[model samples]
Target: MSKGTRRLAAGLMVSAGLMGGVVVGTQPAAAYPSNCHYGISSLGTVSAWCAGGSGSVRAVAGCEWFGWWTTAYGNWVNVNQGASHVSCPWPYGVRWGGFNARD
Candidate 1:
């Protein structure tokens, strides 16, 4: 191949690599469920028993948000009863919620 053609191919390959697999979509994609946010306050309420004894356990019902659901029926949680850290897992790639339980 001509030197100029080879250089152009190499430049194109480098540009593709720099893009980091991001595709420029012509239309904007739909947003996540209108309600879910990542925080304890966002997770309205949960039962005390379901809150777990003292480690990183799953959250109880009503303590999560999913795909516009005011309350997530089934959501996993990571609760640290003593240290002051809590985490909520969201399905479908939704945002997870974390909290300072001790605080």
Candidate 2:
């Protein structure tokens, strides 16, 4: 290619790269409730309690069915309120549990 064409191509590529980086870097962060506590019960219950903050928190329970597939369930509660809980269905056992926060 000619020198001018090559320069134009390089400039376009650099501009595209910079724009891509800006888009990737400018993504919004996740909102989570502060001062939260979580737990998993032996009966396949997942719970979360948030004593402070402005967002909401939820309990996430990962349940296993037929010893093969796993599914997740969740329940939400506002911050500074009572606990939120999620439970697996019958014949499904708890594989894991955790909490999530949202605005």
Task: Report clashes for each candidate as comma-separated counts.
Answer: 3, 0
What's every prediction's RMSD, in angstroms? Answer: 15.5, 8.9
Model 1 per-residue lDDT tens digits across residues 17-79: 777556653455433222112334344333221233333333333332554433333333334
Compose the digit string of candidate 2's lDDT tens values, residues 7-54: 999999999999999988895664557888889887778888888667
- Runs with alpha carbons beyond 4 Å of true place in candidate 2: 1-32
Worst 10 residues of 1 by lDDT: 30-39
Angstrom error at residue 31, model 1: 16
CA lDDT of 94 in candidate 2? 82
Q: Of the candidates shown, which would achieve the greatest TM-score relative to the real structure?
A: 2
TM-score of each: 0.26, 0.61
Clashes of 1: 3
The runs of at least 3 residues in candidate 1 whose Cα sits more than 4 Å from the true structure, single-residue gaps closed, are 21-103
lDDT of 1 at 74: 30
